[model samples]
Target: MRLRRRVSPLKLAVLGGVLFMLVLVVLQRDVSGGIQEPWFEDLSNRKERMLELVRGAVNNLAFQIPGQPGTPQLPAGGEVDKNCPSGFYTQAELKPWLERPPEEPHSQGAGGSAFQKDNLTPDEKKEKEEGMTRHCFNQFASDRISLHRSLGEDTRPPECVERKFRRCPPLPTTSVIIVFHNEAWSTLLRTVYSVLHTAPAILLREIILVDDASTAGGCGVYQERR
Candidate 1:
């Protein structure tokens, strides 16, 4: 019989909190104008309800499966210690995955070539059409790109790079939540890696992923690894 290992309920609860925080960040950041009185009041009133919904969603997303013996958790630490000196988390968390070699020219979407059109053979066209029909996009083309594709360097201006916050009140670390529904495997993973690669571990607490009841074959692989 195959062995199954489940992530603890405590861990799943933590996952819920991460997602909850992410939702709050989005709502707060995307407000068209500054927070008005009525909006703030409504948000305050619904805060408990939102927490309940996030807990339910996270529990639904958690799963049990045989553990992969050697999969190292990204940004391996559970939480960033504020007391640590500058660059401590950066040195610890920036692994070889972020320093990947450049993709070959033959790789789809490499070197800004994704926009270039290719003359498709009849069979290729039929395959592309079928992929689009099933996933509502070109899954065939997406399959050709690496999941860990490089997105090039961070583009911060020189002034932004030079500015530093006070050590006494270090910037708060954040958890990134990615919610996907039947997304292409390559695109989904590329997004995950992109954040991991770009975001400094000093300011990134963790990544929480939520799959919203996806029934596509592309999601099967992730489910199997749960």
Candidate 2:
């Protein structure tokens, strides 16, 4: 009887431990009562914000430009062009750049004006025609002034412009490849100049100009001068 009494306490202790473990497991599962995740709400909000940004980017990409000849000439920055199919910035976003000056030209030097055939000598007419072919590589444009203007005139916010540049000796070289298929004279040169003006000179390995076959060809303007 004494032996049975001592074993009974041991059995009770084991049973109690088993019950405590079972209760603990049941409470672990039911503690949250199958509630939704706390972070799920935040995840949903972030997803909505990302979607909005993507939509804005797509709209901006669909920027316009006048294309058809006799397209009611909207002076540079005059109105949103309907012809340009896509762009990095939207019309509304570009409005600040387009608004005209106070009826007084800031600085007028014959810049990127399309060479007019009306009052040109035969040689001049030929040069102008060839220039047009290179302008868009046979692409169409109803307006040219806004884009052909100098890069200095760009109105973009200077987010990427470095306030301080890091210079290192023995800088690694880089090769820049610019492919042209009847590209415009001013813009092409600008594209090249843009690189030269921005990048560290020591790092520029080689500028490789590969020209795709373009039918546009003409007498070299400098060759005539020479």
lDDT of each: 0.62, 0.47
Q: Write the per-residue lDDT of candidate 2 for residues 1-226, one digit (tens) a residue.
A: 3554356888999999899667655554554466366554455456558769987766443322224232233347655545532223323332321232232133222233342324667876566566566463422222223322333354556853322221211124689999987656445554665566555554576778888886667524321010
Predicted model with the maximum lDDT: 1
**Model 1 pairs whose backbones collide:** none
- What is residue 51's positional error in candidate 2, in angstroms? 22
Predicted structure 1: lDDT? 0.62
The most accurate candidate by TM-score is: 1
RMSD per prediction, one decimal? 20.2, 26.4
Question: What TM value does model 1 have?
Answer: 0.49
Candidate 1 per-residue lDDT over residues 1-226, each given as its tens digit: 9999999999999999999878876666545356666776477547758878987766433311112333222244555455543332234443423555567666656654563448989988898898899778777767666655654554689976554333322446788999988777767877887887677766778889999898865444532110
